[model samples]
Target: MKGNVNSPLHSDYLNNKMKSVQRRHSELKHATPHKLRHTRATLAKQAGTSIEAISEALTHSDTITTKTYVNASNVIPMAVGEIAYRNLKK
Candidate 1:
């Protein structure tokens, strides 16, 4: 239950809380909400989440904008190699 609507948690409060919680962890030195959001988006993309789904989850008006937000690493090289091998074998 929100005790105070006037005192609702905002970005600064969330950022401060994040800093306080991560103060002891040197590895999380640059953990801000923006970075965390991007990381989540990237992870979702890597986990095979559809761009349209990601866009809706992120509340983006345009799917193209969501495409720019995701940072996924995949196996294009391996797929290309397999295709080449199949073509060469025929």
Candidate 2:
């Protein structure tokens, strides 16, 4: 209140005013957007979301890219993951 609104001290207040408005939005200060994208695609695949849909959601030009993301945690994609699960159920 001591300084004019145009003064340097007031500028700091203006700069941080928007920050105090929201507390939950700061969680991304440490988030990895790319890793979240890959994890979401992989989980969607496990939940049986269509590959074409996952590709479109990821803005990928090819479904192969989505498949790569979904299978990044494994090797050989369904050839390994699906076969292992299927054999386990037998």
Give each model a TM-score.
0.65, 0.45
Number of colliding residue pairs in model 1 = 0
- Misplaced by over 4 Å in model 2 are 1-31, 72-90
What Cα-based lDDT does every candidate model obtain?
0.71, 0.66
Tell me how many clashing residue pairs each candidate has.
Answer: 0, 0
- Highest lDDT: give the candidate number: 1
Residue-wise lDDT of candidate 1 within 1-90, one digit each (tens)? 378744546898898889887887767567788777677777666645667888887778988887777764541223556656756888
lDDT of 2 by residue, 7-31 (tens): 3445456446545643557754433
Q: What lDDT, from 0 to 1, does candidate 1 have?
A: 0.71
User: Model 1 reaches what TM-score against the true structure?
Assistant: 0.65
Model 2: how far is 50 from its true place, Å? Answer: 1.0
The CA lDDT at 52 in model 1 is: 87
